[model samples]
Target: MTGGSGGIGGAVARRLAADGTAVVIHYSGGAARAEAVVESVTAAGGTAVALPGDIAEPTEMSELFDAAERRFGGIDVVVNTAGIMRLAPLAEMELDAFDRMHRVNVRGTFVVSQLAARRLPPGGALINFSTSVTRLQQPGYGGYAATKGAVEAMTLILARELRGRDVTVNTVAPGPTATPLFVEGKSEEQIAGIAAAAPLERLGTPEDIAEAVAFLAGPGGRWINGQVLFSNGGIA
Candidate 1:
């Protein structure tokens, strides 16, 4: 799982490990945080290893996959949850910020998906992260949503590209979630307003999103491919 150091990624890693999958936790930085997650997984008697790399770099990502295969014998599922979110209206958004976001979000996902396509064995699954904002049509999310829109498009086509290989490709688009990345900058009112947008009347938890990922990674979701599963609690 990429972004294994982040809240949602950490939850996905732990959940997969608990299900007896040997997890390769990928982090761009935060070696310490990643190590803590590994320790937690190991303490729970699950197998895990932390690997660091820039998801946008082919060489670095290849190294990560190499390490995972070396340690685990094979890779069954690849979940890319590592991404950056910078909100600004299109008019005010700096070109540099937009480029950085696309670098990590769009280009990064593409690179990882490409590697997964070549490396993953039959019966494997590749899960990419997106956001509900694409459907929500929320302002200030233009650039971020564009990247995710590209992800969704790529995901659909990749599934067909891998046809008959029995390797499923899909994207997971989550709604507003209660994570440091989501909660750090918003005021209580803003947060509450977003929470209320969902029928659940609350922000999604990291674990909530992880559950959707686990389903896609597991046998239960084998029939699902070339689709974007929205885990938004009716927000869109």
Candidate 2:
């Protein structure tokens, strides 16, 4: 899992571990946070390891995947939740911010997905992360949404490309969630308003998103290929 140190990513790492699947928690800069997630998983009798690498770099990511395969003997499911979000209207957004977001969110996902497409064997899966903002069409998210839109676009094509490989390529798009990623810059009022926008009347939890991912990666979702699953609690 890439971005395994972030709020939603960490939750996904633990959730997958709980299912008795050995997890390789991948992080970009949050070493301590990633280690904590691994520790938690091991404490619960699950196997997990924290690996650090730049997701946008293929060589580094290839090494990371190699290390993971060496440790676990093989990889069955690859979930990439690594992304960075910077909110600004397209008119006011700095070019640097836009470039950085795309570097991590778009290029990074592409790099990892390419690797998964080439390496994963039969019964393997490639799960990528997207955001519901693409459907919400909210302001200040044009660039960020564009990155995820690219992810969604690549998902279906990649699934088709892997036709006879028995591999599934899918994307999970989450709505407003209570993670640090969503709550960092927003005021309580803004958070509450967005949360209330969903009929569920609350922000989604990371675990809620994880459940959707777990399903897709597990046997239950074998037939669910070439699709984008929105785990957004009816917000969009």
Candidate 3:
């Protein structure tokens, strides 16, 4: 799992671990937090390890994958929850910020997905992260949405490309999720308003997104391929 130290990624790790799957948690930073998650999983009698690498860098990511395979013998599922969000209208957004988001979100997903496609055996699944903002069409999300949109497009096509491989490639788009990354710059009023926009009347928890990811990476979602699943509670 990339971005394993982030809110949604961490939740997915724990959730998958709870299902008796050995997990490899990948983090670009926040080594301490990743270790904490690893400890948590082990404490609960689950198998897990923390690995660090830049998901956007193929060589680094390849080494990371090699390490994971060596440790676990093989990889079955790849969940790429690594992404960075910077909110700004297209006119006001800095090119640097846009580039960085693309590097981590779009390029990162591409690198991970490529490795997954080449390495994963039959029945393996690659789950990528996207945001419901692409559908919401909200202001200040142009760049972030663009990055996620690319992810959606790539995942959809990759699934078809792996037609006979028995591998599923899918994207999970979460809406107004209550992760620290989503709440960082928003005020309480802003959050409440966004939450209320959904009929569920609350922001989605990390676990909610994790459930969607777990389903896609698990046996139940084998028939689901080349699809973009909106896991939001009817927000879009």
lDDT of each candidate versus the true structure:
0.93, 0.94, 0.94
TM-score of every prediction relative to native: 0.98, 0.99, 0.98
Candidate 2: regions farther than 4 A off: none
Candidate 1, superposed: residue stretches over 4 Å from native: none
- Clashing pairs for predicted structure model 3, backbone only: none
TM-score of 3: 0.98
What would the per-residue lDDT of candidate 3 be over residues 1-236, giving only the tens digit for each residue?
99999889889999999999999999998899999999989999999999999999999999999999999999999999999998899999999999999999999999999999999999999999998999999988999999999999999999999989999999999988888888887899999998999998998999999999999989999999999999899999
| Sequence-dependent TM-score of model 1 | 0.98
lDDT of 2 by residue, 106-161 (tens): 89989999999999999999999999999999988999999999999988899999
Q: Number of backbone collisions per candidate, in order?
A: 0, 0, 0
